[model samples]
Target: MTRMPRRSVALAAAVAVLATACSAGGGAPKPKQIATGYTATPQQTGAPKDGGTITVALTPGLSPNYIYPYPPAAANGTVIGRGQMWRSLYRPSGEGDQVADAELSLAEPPAFSPDRKTVTIKMKDYKWSTGTPVTADDVVFSLALLKAALKESPANWSFYTPGQFPDGVSAEATAPDTLTLKLETAYNPSYLLSMLTLLYVMPSAEWNIAETGGEHLDFKDPKNAKAIYNYLTEQSAEQSTFATNPLWQVVNGPYKLKSFDPTTGSFSLVPNENYSGPGDSRLDQVDFKAFTSAAAVLNQFKAGTLTVGTLDSSYVTQIDELKAKGYSVYGAPAPARFDALTINFANTVDNFDKVIAQPYVRQALQRLIDQNGYIASRGIYNGAGSPNYSTAGSGSPYPPAFGDTPPYPYDPAAAEKLLTGNGWKVVPNGVTTCENPGTGAGQCGAGIEKGQKISFTLASANTPAYVGARDVAFSSAAKKLGIEVKIVTKALNYMYANYGNTFAPATKNEWAMQDFGPLYLAAGYPSSNTVFNADGSFNLGSYRNAEVDKLINESTFGADEKTLSAEVTRLAEDLPVLFFPTPHTLVVVKDTLSGPQSSFNALLSYLYSPEQWYFHS
Candidate 1:
């Protein structure tokens, strides 16, 4: 995965002992601490052995809703689960978080035609568990299905425009094993390949439904499109009994679903004996269990019941105790996401627009945030977190590197100076009122009225301990700077529903700023088209910069690393969001199990090389 400079480590062995002492009434003895850095090399027992069952943990309450993996609402768990049964044309290379490299799975490296407007893919010698040979016709059919589904559910596919095929892209099966894609416009090979990675090849025989009157339905027909899309979508949602679902039984990956419980969001998988992949599944079965909170997950770890799980930064101090119990902790800088404070440019609450409209104010706010302190308090893996300076996170390959110096350092004095210089009167823990309110010199930019106070509510998800704490810390800091910040906590779903992209000025859910997330997985890529562009769907803040939009468009089609880096550098210089420290993903696995633990991509499901995972017996 992408590597960042390590932060200075502080030993907190005493804290671990104290925590254990406070909970000594437990039946099991307190776990002992072991001396080590953030990551310890997983212990190897011998040759890999099969037949043992491994239980994995999932995020609480989040279930796999759409088992047939097309995106608008395919939960992370669904990606991980469906991956076992569905195979894509090309699987992302598991080397790290980079999406540039791809491993040929269902199809070999595509042969591109001159001018790069056309490519041909040849099928690999793979077969479905149902004894049917995987063919190119299946690929063409899947692409058609995706195009049709985009009509009814546009958000399902973000990379392409809805209701229309991708610019100049058309697919057809030339032979049983050969499929060709012709593009009208020239596109970068890497970008095109990345696009292909998103399209999962489905079994056409099972998914393509016949319309009423025994006629084959044309998905492109406006009359038949919605019905066809709904039929396929509804079939995938029937997950009350996974084992009994015939649609799920066919497999191309290493595992197949054995059973699933809709209530607890728990499921089990067994090896796909007919899987034709690089390696075979070593474990006989794998189980996934969901928990509501980190504390609950920790309890499972303490009982030595979890085969594989994650530990957040709050649990970093408890690593030694976990190590003493024969668990191996592996830490990797989070490859695909970054935590950030998003300010809504379109915020309509209490004249919030009047104050935050000024770029100087946004820059000032960024400078006032104690990013490093926040990371130190919330991070679990020592030396793993780094300040994210731009939407293109620190881990991204593209960058005008921000280096060690932040554009806006955490200096409250400097922040106060900027605000006061821009015609705002500093009241110190009181409301900051604008004295001048025009675009002229010494004024608070445009749209500000005299005496307009800098006061707004910051919203965030209430769970995950860190989310609430981060917001509180930010709110407290702002308060000291003569800004009134009302902290409102809400469930994640409610927050997203009201504050997400669907947010509008007239809605009851008006938020001045939102403190949620590492940005979505797609934003992790070097391009800013999806997050920073003027019309970006995920631009929840509605921030629009003509220059940034131009740069994003250029990067989207293709750009050299130098050009891409310059664009990112300028973005950091322009404070679009209050970039926080990038969080590290800590993977804790039983000493007896081993496989690839580092994930450089957005989907955690892609992190596991199931064929290679095995019990070290």
Candidate 2:
């Protein structure tokens, strides 16, 4: 949730993200479906205004608590302010085909060596707000600090995989404007670039010192970098100082922090007049207002107090009223985003990890998820969600034929058959038990006791009504097969910061399943590298398979495109997490707001380019 654009922990609940598609309304008014793929390019007759102010709704509960570019998972919020304030080394692209927009990047596309083990990058002529030219030293400092952050804990930076990227690559500024990285292992250009998108540059000369106004030390030294990181993170923890902190004012992006309301987690930004990036800010001020729930957003929208923000689909029936109020609501499936009931493999509660380890048991769980039913039923996603089999999501080219056809469709009978066939005593409306336990056919998987009960907890985020509804549906289905699913409610930010067992060991046995909402990885290349890798920083489930690991490595380090397909396809069947329908992102903008259609890259999710936005008649 820090400076990186890699695996962002996005949720519709507004934790590290804005309000997205969710909620279910009772007794549908007109049975009008929430439209998808309806993004309209902003058009206005009059010339764009010179100066205007707009208030956007930050995802409720996901206000910036930590401002440091890299935050440990416990403190990571959404990328709402970070992207527009402190620029990443490479800007995320709106187009799905490209990993980053070359024009907006601080450096030109990197050139890999003949062996693909080394990379050379040339910097763009850009300056920070302080009038200092951005250079490769800044990028090198960022990477050095990133390595130090990862050193403290892999969870500090969720993108880090043990012995990969920052750990394996040695970087240096060969010249004032050039940086080079020598790699221990060759990498696919696309995969490598995907990792770099998270590399946010800072002012090396200004930030090299560990203390305020101290002598600048060489950040290449691990000791110096770690000390500097510690100091910056400590400063970031003081949320009241966000607007006044001089360390945060030395910006390179389009906006600079103007004010902060610590009580509400709302903040205001002014155009960084010296920003050297692609877009020009026609709006003088951008205010991100935080809310407690989607209903609050709907209230503001109704009161005409909001300019632009996402609206949950539970209010889909009210889109017409908003249209009458001169607002434009667009719904489209977010690119490279996926939602799942992220399982905790390390959660040994009720021998859950051991039972889930069985392929048949995993398949049985998958069969219980009625993705199509959830979307079709008026109470769940209604028509706002799309069926997706792979983490690649809606339009991914990867994955086998299963992309169009689910490998495991919902079937309560099949779920029961699998459990019964696996030597489980299935009792409808009662706890099912393992009648037989052994590493043989017709026996429950190893580690499961002879009389193990099939019951586990499912933690559901208490925001966005659709999430709870889906979990309830799944739980109801599980009950028919005598599998007990205890539903517990938790806040989205609580899940984002404290739920992952890999980083937050204290909470491992607290829950068996979690659905905080969709997590968006890098836009173009959505490879599940650290997400599913055995030792991945974000491997919350702790699910492991040597075969899937080998396939992921081939796709991440190998050059073949089909290798990525093989990786996603294998993951689709393996079910590292229980898949859910990918919901459409619904954004509501005031009619007066005018920008190119591309500016409304709502489907891309999380990265907001307000610099390109303007008000027009």
Candidate 3:
């Protein structure tokens, strides 16, 4: 129950005029889906013109890392999954549901090869605000840069892999308006489609400097590769600078980046006039305003200053209050982005070989806790949630498939049975101990110095969802097994301290488990090679399973989904990070915000075309 500020409301009213004036002859398009709460009659053709600025409030803060499109980096993926960026290729009508055949931004629907090894994208004539044509060269440049970064600066590229482009796969400009990717093998076409969906096609002309090495690679040199990388790297959300190059061209999506001011923390997006699509432009302008507190956002919405913004955990309990105040509150499900307990198994003394190595122990650990009750208590946004295996497997070995047999059920009895059956013995006070199968009496079990205690501190952000879910669920479940779990909450910076190459051996040892969300997976396949390598930069939990490692590598270059699934199943059976729920993103937009909900990766594309959004007078 916060109120919108007067300045914000006045600004919004100005935006309404700007949007209507700009709508002119270019009428807004009717989206397949309408706003969940607020009902606004559609703007007439040639009525609400495309133009003006609409202000929005982006979360915690915007990191320039936002650049990673479709197949998002670990950080950027979090934003896309949150529904900030819109998708152009495979947009879901609402939330992260089933994908639509085609979206307004795509020139033509995506096409796959017979073997599903290659995907070709035909660029629409949509131009960037600067009036440059978006071409395949831009696409090729982006992928090539990704491949190069993965090869050279692995620590930086730890979130993603260039395996998407195998030995035989290469990107080339098939035509002025098309980009074709020839894959090395047949795999899930969804992977490529997903990656491309969020990728912002930057002008190759602007980024080619990064491709030329040596003399042109210096970060200080404006014309060098360093300069290009610096631009992208500096823009990462970590820096919180939302700068845009007016010279940049965008041919693949609906709207263009209008103005971005890092100083004021405000941005404006305008519609693309050349866009070829169905219905388009209900609003003339979208103004994005930044607020440091959720309270401020709620106030603005309540005051009718801002039409759209997200509610934070603190306000989650007040949905009824907002509704009673005549506010249309739409609750969508969010993806299981950071809901995990990532154990840095590499440093743990927990008999990885004898205890964790057992498949049943892993399953037992997974089943001992009830995820349903935890989600219910927290009022997890949407009713949509599923217990996930380590490999995003909830029902089926695959995701979104919802397989028949739920992988692991919450059963402490079964967990105890599995442990005792596997050579573990129960002591007097719910504690369990195991003897060194090979050693003498004093070597293992409780009260003996032979074995160390199986307890460690868990580190995560202080964010409500993260701290609340992780602390309650993990601690309760672990305690049942005589394992002492200590929870540590830190600021975002300190929490992700070990993100890439910046981890300390001592710090790594102090903690056994941490919370982590996967960077966006192109095809949504799980590969832990770059993530779990013994010395790999992102191997935060230090959990290592040669078997799981091998499987991940095999799946990375696997010929197809079946081949990859087989490997994934093997890894899932050997639980690494106690994968819980892989939920779809839940975006709560105001009733006045009209457009498609969202699918897996099309969130960004939706933003680019908000002018296509209509509002009632």
* Most accurate candidate by lDDT: 2
List model 3 lDDT by residue over 1-617, tens digit each. Answer: 00001001132332343344235344432111211332222222223434344556655433223433422233422222112222333442222222233544444666887777677878766554346776666666655555544444444443443343333567778898887878777545544444444444545664455322322232222234334654455444432333343223233444555555555446555555664454465456667676554577778767767665555533454554566664454433232132456655555445433444445656767776566544433333222344455443332224422243456667777877765665566442356666344233323332323344445566654342423343545565677787666666544434554432224566655556655332322224333444554544556555666766665555554445455465555655566657655443323444444544332123321233354456533
Clashing pairs in 2: 3-69, 16-78
Q: In candidate 1, which residue ranges exceed 4 Å CA deviation? A: 1-36, 40-45, 71-80, 93-97, 158-167, 210-226, 378-384, 502-509, 520-525, 559-561, 596-606
Off by over 4 Å in 2: 1-32, 36-46, 73-80, 602-604
Q: Is candidate 2 or candidate 3 better by lDDT?
A: 2
Report the Cα lDDT for candidate 1.
0.65
Residue lDDT tens for model 1, 475-574: 7678888898787766664554456452243543367777654553432355555566666655667777888877765655553435566667777888
Clash totals for all models, in order? Answer: 5, 2, 81
State the TM-score for model 2.
0.93
Candidate 3 residue 197 Cα shift, in angstroms, is 3.6
Tell me the TM-score of each prediction against the true structure: 0.87, 0.93, 0.71
Q: What is the C-alpha lDDT profile of model 2 across 537-562, one tens digit per residue?
A: 77887889999999889988997767
Q: Model 3, poorest ten-residue lDDT window?
A: 1-10
